[model samples]
Target: MRCVIAGGGPAGAMLALLLARAGVEVTLLEKHADFLRDFRGDTIHPSTLRVLDEIGLAEAFHRIPHRKAYGLTLVTDTGASRLADLRGLRGGYDYIAFVPQWDFLNLLTAEAAKYPSFRLLMNAEANGLIRDGGTVRGLRYHDKDGEHELRADLTVAADGRGSTLRVAAGLAPVEMGAPMDVVWFRMPREDGDPGETFLRVSTGRLLVAINRETYWQLGYVIPKGGAERLRAAGIEELRHHVGRLLPFLAERVTLLGSFDDVSVLTVALNRLRRWYRPGFLCIGDAAHAMSPVFGVGINLAVQDAVATANLVLKHGPSAVAAVQRRRMFPTVVTQFAQRVAQKRLIAPALEGSLRLTRVPELARIPVINRLTRTFIGNGVRPEHVASR
Candidate 1:
């Protein structure tokens, strides 16, 4: 457990292999050791799906509990539209699958077993980062071990957007937008296909679907910390919110049952000004936190892992060299896309104008529908197989 990982997420787990395979012993630490049964980070994008295939985890990914998804769904106050039947995209991996992220991580955790050089430490909390002349040299972590300073050739902050390492290192992710958290629940299996998915629009409420399941991944469009008040208003108010959005869910709306607390995530994503400094580096949400809207977070995060691993394999000891080695691909893509996604994708929609007027209009535009289809369709591959 010499190569210290500040987080046990995908980036951290995947990084352990890259370092271990390179003969660097890795220690992965997690705040919460067990995966909770909840709805979170479900969409595995086409780009990321390919990365997993290349990493030799395709079978593991498929074996995880999940449902096959084809494309994105758009639902307005009136109706729904389908995008990119995934079976029809070119030069893009052509399929999107909806596996709960917790399950996916569990699968990766099991597969990390192939490498004995890797050690996973669960329930380990990283209190602060250790630095050397402005470079992060190590981490001070506490678990059953109580408190210990673990030394490593490198320290990676694969922690979440609220990264403790980032804070301790005094690096703030540039605020692109704010976290936009959601409260979501799934319906019991429907008799028929849920029909792609839906993005039902209404005042103070937003309902969306989780691909083909009878269940829909629904949300309320409220500011942060609004879930308790929503729950207090009772199920009837929530039901009323759903009824105005889609009549189809009228009978089934009750089936929404009870919604877990609405977790708020700032939708405004931020990328660290510098991804690495000397003996340390950050990856995944630790480096650049993205909004959940486009469902691109997982894909981008895995790509970060692959890129980091590749660089670590190519270079040794020098995180400077590793970062320099990775300078080309992943960093380039991350840099190139950040501004565009911030300005074009999320900002204009969230802050520029009232989202109410635009959502229905956007869903109705044939061009927009075509764009959604094209985006999702690209996730599918020409061979109709996922990358692996």
Candidate 2:
């Protein structure tokens, strides 16, 4: 194979698809047998929608059972405020699509299967890198049968935040520290429930309620390293917290019988100083683990894949550093914005100091409103599908 990509994520899957479409032999390794993991980053932003349009998959993506969010709303103790209105965005795809990550990945991989040069190895876990002196030859992975080494001209790691291949390549990301972690759980949704997804902020608690049609996939944000304290307080305490946050769900909060119903996400914000080493490159969560502030993780990873495929197909594996150079600015800008929100908004809210009275007015301001819409809708330096 010319290229071997570890991790069948947005980055690796999309890159493999593009390379195969351009007649390059690419093999993609996915440890999981299927893409059915829940509580993952599911927001597909406008920039990604535009890329799908370019690649002729926009209509197909829209076919999936998903919800369209035109704007993000912040509900505080006082009132709800508009964060970013996507209706004013330029592209036809102004709204963000909330589709299950599995559905999205399945769509991409299925499309890639059309190309003869593409190969997907399910249940193949890339455990280490295949090194040839200072360069990476490919990777060593294990499947159900046994351990095997897959050699190729280039190796790309899109494995995720806890990427084993990145560790094998002797690269570490700088930990930038997040102020909060999230406990995710689901509660039943009713006919009269709030329809739009919104972020709710109270004195010392922050919760996000995403309308997942039948159920509300909620994330209760707590202070960093606060999961232990939360569990110690007991599951009923968590039920009380949920009841206090969303009164409509008070009756159903009891459904959370124990901590087993919730998944704790230890938020980490970090990025690799250098994203490539010789024939190896790291992208997506492997390169930068993003905070779930604006829910831009999936979009940014797709953007990285688009940029990587455009460069690599045009200039071959020698363009590895150029991919990082092209993508680093957007990564830095997005992470900086997330860090700012963590410090100014989330941290204070968790500390019972910040108020949202000014947020509504500030969001209405022309300059800030326009910037917020552009930032959330298109992101920084959004990439397009380059024609081969």
Output the lDDT of residue 6, model 2. 97
Root-mean-square deviation of candidate 1? 4.9
Question: Could you say which candidate leads in lDDT?
Answer: 2
**Candidate 1 deviant stretches above 4 angstroms:** 90-92, 202-205, 212-214, 223-232, 255-268, 320-388
| Weakest lDDT window of 10 consecutive positions for candidate 1 | 379-388
**How high a TM-score does candidate 1 get?**
0.80
Q: Write the per-residue lDDT of candidate 1 for residues 1-388, one digit (tens) a residue.
A: 2578888776787677656655568888888868564656667766666666666777778777667666556555445545334554444456778887777777777767667887888889887878777666789988886898877778888888888887887778777654234656544545554566545544444555565354566654544455677778887787776667666566766765565433433354667777777777888888877666656667666666766666565565464445534533544454445556445533443343425443344434666656665544332221121111
lDDT of 2: 0.92
How far off is model 2, as Cα RMSD? 1.1
Candidate 2 per-residue lDDT, tens place, 1-388, comes to 3999999999899888888889888999999999999899999999999998998999999999999898889988787888777787997788989999999999999999999999999999999988888989999999999999989888999999999999998999999999999999999999999999999999898999999999999999999999999999999999998899899999999999999999999999999999999999999999999999999999899999999899988888888899999999999999999999999989999999986664565467789878998999999999989964
Clash pairs for candidate 2: none
| Cα RMSD, each candidate | 4.9, 1.1
User: What lDDT would each prediction earn against the true structure?
Assistant: 0.63, 0.92
